[model samples]
Target: MTRIPDQPKRLRIVPISKLAAAPKWQLETLRALREPVFFWFTAGQGRITLGGSTRGVHPHNAIYIPPGTMYGFQAMTRTQGVALHMGDPTGLDLPETPLHLRLRDGSQHAEVAQIMDAIQRELEGAKDFAERAARHQIGLLAIWLERQRSSAGDDSPRGLSSTNANERLTARYSTLLERSFGSALNVGDYAQALGVTPTHLTRACRASCGRTALQLVQERRLYEARRLLSETDVPVQDIARNLGFSTPGYFSRAFSAHTGTAPSLYRKARGA
Candidate 1:
């Protein structure tokens, strides 16, 4: 069956248990993804670590982890869940930081469940304009989440209108990184663009995601490098130049340091 059809090719929907089977899940440090993921836990309990924060997850709770966020998931019970992996889904707004929410009302839970089912159906049977239709459904889910936060009383300060200052700054920095990663932008340049000092930006990054601003830029660069290597026949030297690297040797060293493999071999291993 199709999973997250009509969504970006990188987007995926899969069972939580299957995700947990990856080798990184057993390690003390979990490898993160280049896209955001929302986990809907139907049954059982688990613990999700996002950045420097860890939270407990129960049935009917939804957890979101943004891209480049270091995270790990653990299930203490027989966890049954659906993971929605996303890539800049347009027309949908969500929290910038990791989120864990419990839909205590039966109707609320039912509505969310229905939306997820509709997403699956669109992927499976909607052959015409399927991507557009699926996006509309996904938008509905985002609106549903926003409504829940609004009705959730004062604790919903994380909404678009009133996200925490640190998180907002970090989110802004993240958005800028997404748009400008191809250029040779430094941390100071990013800070200047955001109208904040490099130190202030670093403080915000530390408070919000437990990573430095430089790391974010590097991560984005590496993500792009890997994508080029695995999805195209682009020569490593050409890829390096495209990504603004001064030399192929530097790119190769950086790639090796981050992935523990040379760029060409990594590409070959993925059957590119």
Candidate 2:
């Protein structure tokens, strides 16, 4: 059966199969961009730096860097690989959270690299064969992601997935936060979905990120509230309800706890 192409405008998903397999990477050479680039080093290992500080990304590592993020890289060893460079036109806005994905040692590294390469080939040539190839490759990629989740043992931190587990978990949790932060007030719920216990999840969250899982959830909700108050004519009561608050007074109190000023005053100060 012929399948619809998975190409998104402004989001180029290139599989390495079509591109020159071995493109040399040089740290001394700088490549600046006016757009964000999401590169997946599926096969080779490399290290990156920003403003002289050593940045870390290796094989099976993928990165979503915003335009002008000021970064560079050096290959740790000689290797050939594929990369996907997604320019920021698709409005697939990356979250304000971390975008770096580092694969764990001894994870299904080769399989992940193969998945990326297959996607690149499909993207490069989307003919009937390529379409099927892309679909198959995407499934493999999902399987690798799943394996990461299942491998996080009892000793593993809550968000730890073996194959870029922490990063994948964070991305999933970030999506959940955006969708139901106001309503889902329990970290355990998020942990359950991520195949982790609440405590481990929180620790993984704090280690991979400087903030607690609860903090991220609350921050996202609060930021939404602030945006609504400042950008629209929504009343405080309605806004509170929209944010899953039972009462305007409660929302106001919570908002005030996080920010020194109450929601109404903060909105007014911003002339909203």
Candidate 3:
């Protein structure tokens, strides 16, 4: 005769009691290949069995599992946190980062629970800006988890470094572009950081990324300009200056060239 252990009904909510009850209602669901499932545990601990190993992922711990990475999880005990089911995920669109978090002491439980509570509210109510709010919180949670893990003296799971010199140079350049695109906006400066000549940097970037270093700089700047245009109420000339363009005319011309529309017109068309 075959034996089947009693399991909690599918998608049933379990009440919070003590730590031992955490795994009482362990549930498993085979999500789609590209689903974004964000996990947070603020109450009890649990074992996350993934990739043929059972690892403990507890409170203040978070990870972003890439698509096609076979994994499953169960609670350590009956605990509460946000289990966000991200919608329509394209693998590259998500952050390629995993987070491990820890608390200073008992005091951090409240803070962690607060963050999860906010996410839970957004998930439950389904408000107009819930998705936006949840995304913002997720970014914040990622940052917070990294800091917590660093403080706890665990930094083992960062992404692999780029393979070649050109790839390394491009990665560093991309980081600098993200930080300074709004002000310094210079490919030469990024090259200086990499201890390489501008020509070499341009060649490396072109070979590895199929674009010149300057083109990457312009691309990032233009990207920021477009984001601000579509999301904020800033003036056009100010946006140009903010993006480090020398003049409004130059910015307008560059924007037109890249996007085939004036910044203002583009924003207007998008109903920003």
Local error of candidate 1 at residue 135 (angstroms): 5.6
Can you write out model 3's per-residue Cα lDDT over 1-272, one digit (the tens) per residue? 11212112121112233323432212322111334455656656766533323357666555455433333456445655555555544322454533334343665666556666676677668799886676666566556555555455333432222136775566566556655666864777778887899999898777655667787677656756776677677788888887788999999999999888999899998788
- Per residue, candidate 1 scores C-alpha lDDT tens digits across 20-130 of 554441322333566777788888877764444445678888776766555556554467878887666444565556666777779978988888888777777859986
Q: Scored by Cα lDDT, where does model 3 land?
A: 0.57
RMSD of 1: 6.3
Top TM-score prediction, candidate number: 1
- Tell me the TM-score of each prediction against the true structure: 0.70, 0.44, 0.47
Per-structure clash totals for the candidates: 0, 8, 5
Residue lDDT tens for model 2, 111-187: 66666666776777767777555556554544554455455465553122232455455545655655565583578
Query: What's the lDDT of the predicted structure labeled candidate 1?
Result: 0.70
- lDDT of all predictions, in order shown? 0.70, 0.56, 0.57
Give the runs in model 3 whose Cα sits over 4 Å from its true position.
1-122, 125-159
Clash number for model 1?
0
Model 1: pairs clashing at backbone N, Cα or C within 3 Å: none
Error of 3 at 41 (Å): 22
TM-score of 2: 0.44
Model 1 TM-score, 2 decimals: 0.70
